[model samples]
Target: MGSCIICGTDVEGDGRICRSHQEDVVFDFRGNSPDQLVANRFYRGVVDGYADFGVFVDLAPGVTGLLHRSELDVRLESLEWEPGDDVFVQVTGVRDNGNIDLAWSIRQADREFRGELVHDGDSEWLPTDQADETEATDTAVETEPVEATSETEQTETAPTETEPTETADEPEPTETASEPETTETASEPETESAVEAAAEPADSVTASDERVTVASLGDRVDETVRLEGEVVSVRQTGGPTIFELRDETGVVDAAAFVEPGVRAYPDVVVGDAIRLDGEVERRRGDLQVETEALAVLAGDDADAVETRLAEALTAEARPEGLQPLAGDEAVAGLGEGLLDAAEAIRRAVLESRPIVVRHPATADGYVAGAALERAVLPLIDDAHEQSDAAYHYFTRRPTDEPVYGMDAATNDATRMLQDRDRHDEKLPLFVLVGIGSTTESADGLDLLSVYDVEAVVVDAAVADAETRAQVDTLVSPTLESVDADLSTGALVSSLASAVNDAVRSDLVHLPAVSYWAETPDRYVTLARDAGYDRERIAELREAVALEAYYQSYQDKRELIDDLLFDDGGDLAAHVSAQFREKLETERETASANLVTESVDGVEFAVLDTDAYTHRYDFPPTPLLLDDLHRHHANGDAAATVGIGTDELYVRSTGDLSVRSVASRTAEIAPEADVSTAGRREGKISFLAGERDAVEDAVVAAIADAF
Candidate 1:
């Protein structure tokens, strides 16, 4: 037991601070697990990296927490903290799955706190002032006995011939504290000569007698073995150069150290087939090879390794059979496209290439992206042993627009180039869901194709020929039949199941939640079988819709997971209430301002969105128009149009093409500069000055089509 550093109150067992005074002192967490964290207590952490929605902070070598942007006072990009920079935060909560939630702290510096303590999972916390002294004393006591014993052995008998080679592993006494000083007195001259002898023949011809594959390296730990593979990636860290080597079996990181921060084997670059002799060791629970020597292979040796890798990757990348989640005939017809996409995704995982998922910030888009996220994350975890490998391998980014615009393409290209140049990472495989199925996304796809980046698009929109040609793979129902009213979420959710089959059970209920009403009978039965009732499904959909609106540009990965996959009934109910309240308020306002008109025997309901609705808040113009059309446009020939300052959304009970409407309106009102904004959502944009003319022309065009 110890007394609180701030108030002098008695603390509980093995604790340093009382509950009341815990906030008064800043803690330096040296523990390696999230269970050691005390909620609502401040601790010092180092910035690990950045994501779209948050920043990751490391409380210890093995413990990391996410500080979401919602918990920050300013924008995430405005923060100047770089990797390895120290910051302070509060542990908000720890999840059941060991994910830690963090909040920003105003007290960033240690001097701001009244007291400082180090929590190393010891019986009692140690004061910061005494931590260094205790560590030094323990180190001295541990080293002196070993040096004394080794000195006595040196005096009592002459060292054997084999001792020098054994001591050669310890380079020098002053290099690192882990290297003992006993080697200096035991075999100084002999050890130096042995090290020089080992360096001279690093490139000598070594046979494949004891060469081991990466998959079989687990049993070879602590034993020196030769490995032949191509260097896929090379990263320079503060202590060593980590070369990611990939053979026919798997990929493994081989670390070579040449002093601190210096590159080892600088001549060896990526894509070079090489043979290395290293001892396999587990570092932080991940297998890492400590390279004793590495040499790039040439001629037949390099060619043979490359051929082996290509054949193995081809065989492993392709899936057995493209199985549809349900017996939906329309979805089954898209097996060929779906199979190609799934193969590309699986191949990216095998090659250690990152996957970037781009989707719109709508409920349907979120469901689709989250479904794919659920499937791909586990495969990444199983492939790489690094704790943060999932974050590095897969990313889901939300776009505000339905089309893959140039702005998004530019952002992705910039980030990918920076990662490749700085960290030697491979260019990512882009998977666009519920978007990029039309000609509007061609420019963006072209920009990425300039660098040979592969893209796979999964959507239910009537895809265009140019866009289909641009992407590497496209999965859509238009190619089979247009009679099916399939939602984008339903289509991509099925695609996600094809990407990974282990999560098939978890994804059975997702297609039902993607629909607002009139869900297909097959999906309804699937949801019921998965134990999700009608009320629960509605609540999940409403919750995702509301949350998707708040941060339309951010992925909101964990929160979305809580709403969809995790048993978060209370959270879903709470957010759904806000969704209803906001939508009801917007509906009342838009309904009162609506005007009914008839055009050539066709009924039309029009609402001036600029005058009646909130422009930048909840219940956006698109969602509002959807609800209004369902209420007012009950007749087959009736249509609802919500006209904003420069845009209008059309919702009808019959077939309508927003692009055709825009084209006809452009001819009728040539001065308006009309253009289609969204194809499937029935959206058009026009010059704000000619809003009235554009509205009248669009109504007339719809009447002619009707």
Candidate 2:
């Protein structure tokens, strides 16, 4: 033994250097076992070559180590050491190829040792000659066993660590470690942020936007709401999927994302009713719901949706918390009373006869008062009705008529006279004329005398002069053998003045005897014959014939008496003698011309009855046409009177250029005195041709009357 050369220590045995410094050291005999000598020095060398060819390393200066590649731990492949790079080497064995076998387990052993030193905070021996000798001496007794255990452990553990490290090292370990961690950490935040963002309130989410439903994606929505409506259309786009839902309010679009690995149903079409739940989201400046779930519901579901909408609208329309007043008994009672009054009036108008009934002058004046009393009195007797207040006067006037007189003081006198004439004298006449002058026009002058006769002699004569004149002129010409007496001025004035009074007061005064005929003789005869006892006609005829014949004879005798008898004492006998002589001559002539039904044999005679004798005393009732013209010319209110099968028509002559009042059916007699005091006032005003004013006045009058 000698001192080692690498790291100096005392050497021993066969004149060789120590293992720490065994440069150029070898055994003496060529075929001898080298295991007898202990190799001390471990050299630091480069891996010169690697493969099954062997791991060649410099060992002991010039002596080379040829370690088998298979014997090396596979984990060392990650070291990437090339030629001339330093690595710890040791002598493992003497190979048959005459090369020293080397080991690099010292490098791994050093890493383990350093790790242990760091973890345990311990210092151990460095790889020097003195330390190696000391370590060898300490482990000398167990060296072979320790060495075998290390080899076995290395063989087993190295294979596993080597495979993964080897694959990672082919790229770069630092680059590989950084790439995956970056991706995974970045992706995790995105998922978490999405859930947090979707947790917002619905109002905030839907503000200023429209929501569309995305079918079958309900799970993705954090807050899903329901939309019930009819499906207007479903469409598939190559790039994306969308559908349209329509309700009465409006239409909205539904959209969804096509997930991978899911099959799409293409046959789904439009007009399907569905209920959908979805998230409202923003798309292209509009709020749209991304649908999560969609279901095809029955038609009743759509009906339910509509019902809900209608209920909402109805709720909006109702006034908040308002209710009707309770327990208004008085108001209810009043309403019932009004309804009863209206029913009574309707019944009266329907059931009443055509005759003009006179109103009593004392308590119930005016025909309307009488009619109303008649209608309501029975109801009152039953104890189920009550009467409203009634105002009394001789005649009733429409309220719209102008209030005449200098003042209230002057009105009493005029009204008194009017009342006296209307009730006491029964002389008030209302002449409704159509297209004529005044009621006293020449064509119907004698009308006044007839009305006066009817009024004074027969009592209570109210006539319409205009209607009489129309009969004498237009109606009379159409009838056979009728004559009209048109000359009589005093009678005309009296009748005209009476009619004017009624017109001014807006009162319709009807006559007791209404005589209207198509022929002139019929007009006069009807007037005279009315109220005459038809049973006494034969006696009355003989009286009239004798009186007429005597009067005629007296007229001729008066002419002879005026010339021959200065004193008129024998005039009556002379008249009787002259009447006999004329009768004898007329009888013989009549007998010669007589045939069995001879018309010529009949003696034509004029009557000297009370009607003919006192005809000049009474004013005639005016005709309808004449009254209309008088009112029209004098700018007074007038109406046309026409009789229908069931009712009387009193039309205003104010705006009527046609000059006739027409019934619902046939044309009526223009001369007929159908005028009644209770009739409504005409629209015509005292001032003519003021149609607009008159219309307003008429409407006012009707309202007041009702």
Candidate 3:
């Protein structure tokens, strides 16, 4: 049977004892007697009893020894210790009660064996059964115990053959018997080995098969064990209850199958420190320990929880390579930083001599002069490459100037350069100011000139339509008369309509007018000067005002009134009456002119009813003669012209379709070689009397002769 070297008690043959006494099994040492042995030295021991600290071992046949917990490494506490296992041990001390305490020297012996194996090429098996024979041979050669027990006990034990063969099958049992003697023989080497072994517990635990950490608990999952952690959170579902536990390393979830009465106890809360005894089982990819018993140890530290949360948030907020400084710390303002950069920019602007500050596109606050300089200096540097305008600000001062603050000299210089830029670039200073429609004092004009503003936009809400229209007609023409290259610019009623009308009318060719409802009176002047009528201008003005007002109050009636009419009157009647008078006068004058112009070509005489019928069918000469006879008969007025042959012929027809014809034969004859005057007269008479049948026939004969 296997036994402990120190206690000489029988141990189980499995080469193991209770985990509490494993130190005794692995580090057996011996001396004259257990009482005479020093504490924590080599001793042979048998496992007699078990406790949380260690197993009680018997040294020197009957002397019981105690192996305290501190003497053994943590690896021993995790092993499956049995009572019959063979054990080696070291003597700790003789207690007051005559008990000799023992400790396992396995780690020390293993180190010594490894060292001897490295140098002498001897294995640990030599120390088992052959240990006594090797010691006998050493004693035979040397008389003194000190000289016989040199560090290389392996060399002394190498030649013993008989005991080596006997102990080959039971090396562990033999080791328990001989381990304490070997420790005494090789004390110096063993001491050094123990020191080295103690220094590296990680390597020792790895070398031992008995250490039980989480990594080693895989085989014992059915056995319950205890774990401790703070509760991060808890979740309960229909099947089981899950608890999240966190330690310094990381977080893991532990679950418990709900037994009948387990839920009635105090519920687990977040931030609770708890200890759990459970069997670990794998569910899905995770190792879940099924808790059989749970107990609340203490409450979680609130400060620690907050600290951890803050750390997590900080880790998430950190940029890829940069971290924000913790606690209160001042960073430079953007405006201040730009001002520092603007020194170089100031030099560039000064070199450029003249720079115009145009109105910014966005409606935010105005940019400081220093900020503007910083923004524009780079552009100036680029422009300089092309040998364009050179204008910028320059500084001559020893003191640091506050950003955007200009000294008197610098201000004057700036004004000079700005004026020069205005002249040189032919660009206007765009200023945003409100000019009221009724404010005819031209105070804004003075401000405009001072600011070198090319255009002024008046607020239409405060301005009357008539005033704005008058301003439009007056100011624009006045500017033209004075040879000032000033043009009024304003917005249209609606952006879409404005764009459409601008495109169709080529408004860009005239001037720039943007329609924004924010200012109505200005737009009214703009519309009227652009040739919109007064009523239309008023309607547009109201539309702009309505939109502006709606922007504040959302009033629908105002918008409709602006869209429909200038004032609530009969718009249709007013428009109709004006056009109707003009059209009627035009029609009467046209008719009178037509009658006066047509009356110069014909002559007639009044006749009696019977005579008028008789005279009507006659050609001009005959009709003249018929008229003469009718006038003689009735005393009516008549006229006559002398006839020529070029005159062709004449006849008359009465009003009742009776005809009378008469002509001189020579006058009726076709003209032959007629004078130019005679041909002209004949053509005239032919055209004049062509409707008469006799005149038609005579004109045809005259043409044939010609």
Candidate 4:
């Protein structure tokens, strides 16, 4: 025997405490038999699994209980539980079918049950004879209430050997000297409960008896009901603790003004599974529950709630064998890991985790980012009832360059850190579309990694080996050996479709929009089938390109939506006309004033960007260079180099390394002050005096770099 941790008294074992302190002592049950188990006794258990019907909890080996949805006080999906988590629950029943029913216990934390934990049970504490006597006494006590309140005034009563007790005013010993001491002491057990029941009120309902959902609360206004659910959000508004509670059916705010900003319920926190008894009322044009009582469902009951939620989530399977939007073999082969990437993005939406999409400020990048925005926004709207959830959960930022660099990385880090400190937000999942593929982005990627931020890099560019380690998911062309000339939009459009297959048709015109030249046959057919002719598809490309160039930083969501999704085709037509006019004018100007040369048997058409072209006008430097190269350059291995006062923007028919040129130029013409700037733009800065010597060296350098 051991002494109770509370007021000193004999306990059967070290884990045991006296009956008066039983509620204070949380138990860890070892036995599984319903025969010895006391109904309504809370015990610690592990969450086993979830089912659509409810969560299954393992009390012990061969003992499990169901916390049915009918018993849920909150939304099933709102629960933030993973399997194997510990929780507390009360065993409501061990039925005839051997199905154990559990109720959510509001008291979840050890501090709430502050006494020492005991691992003993009634059967474990008693000998066989003593155990039988205890069981009989409990049975007799249960029947006394019914017997005492009989309709029949003439009641048959079993007589026992006992001395009569005195009135309450002058209480005396109930047992006489002649009475057997053991029998009288045993009879004492029967009267204890009878006396307690008579003293306790009849109308007072047990808090553990009933639980209801928020959806059913509308009909129950002005009526007090017990509810169980996770605290979605806790706001201390200086006047009250407003806990936003969500159940499977709906959400309701439960207000507790007693403690005001002092935290009315100190133990209550966001994501806690709690049971509350409150009167439903309409407050300021919205429904709210004025909480009278609150309990944190802890230990096994908490685990059961989460376990059930997990099971239900598991049962709702992700869509599998999703067909790629692009039906090409190379794209299909590259899509091996696309499904996993999509599921991750989709889960972030459901969890309400913020998503930051970093895409290059190009038509291809804009279209890809737009496709995901189209797919994910609807999901965010559906996942959360809040109208602003999409804005809160999703963000798309355009990169001025194709790579995720230090500048971009610093901006993202600053925003995320501020968000964490100000709003306690979850670190966002960084989705790099058409960006973050080379060694250039390593420093930026490393910065995000320090905070353990998860990232997904989706690019058509063949990423360097080092880039793979910096991201969670790297969907790049290099992974698949088949190096097809696919655009970034082609890759992410299909990935967006996989993220939400329902948006597949909406993305049909994207693949065709990505390729500025030689629009692929497969993608062209896809656009046509979706009712987008060549003219319509070209307009979208031009429209995206136009918008992509102007902001070059912001995600023009509404304008892009009208260009991409609107059937009127007016925006696309108007934008495409402007794009053609500006592009043609720039191309003609570049064609007129261009220096053509050949070195080491390779053709080179160089344009002086600062001297001949409008530096700040329509058709950005990169776009103008691409058009100049394709239109003015010729031969099998031709290249266009736009030489500025210090920088060289190169567009080529083949791979060329500016770093090699920079290294070689330093050796040949060190006075040129050559250095690499942007890898994606193939940008290299050098002195203008070295233009003649630098141009000659670069032509020879391109030959070797290729």
Off by over 4 Å in 2: 1-225, 229-273, 277-294, 299-706
| Cα-based lDDT at residue 193, candidate 1 | 37
Which number leads on TM-score?
A: 1
> Could you say which candidate leads in lDDT?
1
What would the per-residue lDDT of candidate 2 be over residues 331-375, giving only the tens digit for each residue? 122232223223322222212101111211210112222222233
User: For residues 1-706, could you state the per-residue lDDT of candidate 4 as single tens digits?
Assistant: 8765444588775434567555444456667575555576677788898889888888787788898865653445545546887777778878887888988765453322333232434432211112344444444323222322211111112222233455333222231111122443565543443233222321243443567777687688878888877676654432345676755444566765332122456567767877777677764335677665677788997786667545533432244756777576666776666766786787666444689999988888898899899989987776554434577679999988757889999999999886665343567888998888788788999999999999998887778899987789888776446455788898888888888888888998888989889888889999998898888888888878987998688787767887888649776888889999999888888889888877777777888888888887778888888877766775443788898777778787875666777788677777888877666678887887888788777777876665
Worst 10 residues of 2 by lDDT: 112-121
Tens-digit per-residue lDDT, 1-706, candidate 1: 6676545677877676778567756777888789888899888899999999999999999899999998974558678789998888999999999999999886554423445566875644534133244344444323222321210011101111233456644433222222232433335353343334334334542434467888888898887778999887886542456788888877887876543233567788888998887778875467778776777888998898989888887887777766666666667778888889988998888788999999988888999999999989987776664545777789999987878979899999998997787567899999999888898888889999999999999987779988888988998867448535678788778888888988989898888898887888888888998899899999999999998999788778778987999855899999999999999999989888888889889999999998999989998888888888877454543789999888888988777778888999999999999988878678898999999899889999999899
lDDT of 4 at 609: 88
Q: CA lDDT of 399 in candidate 1?
A: 87
Q: In model 1, how large is the Cα lDDT of residue 631?
A: 72
TM-score of 1: 0.75
Cα deviation at 683, candidate 2, in Å, is 16
Ranking by lDDT: 1, 4, 3, 2
Clashes of 2: 49
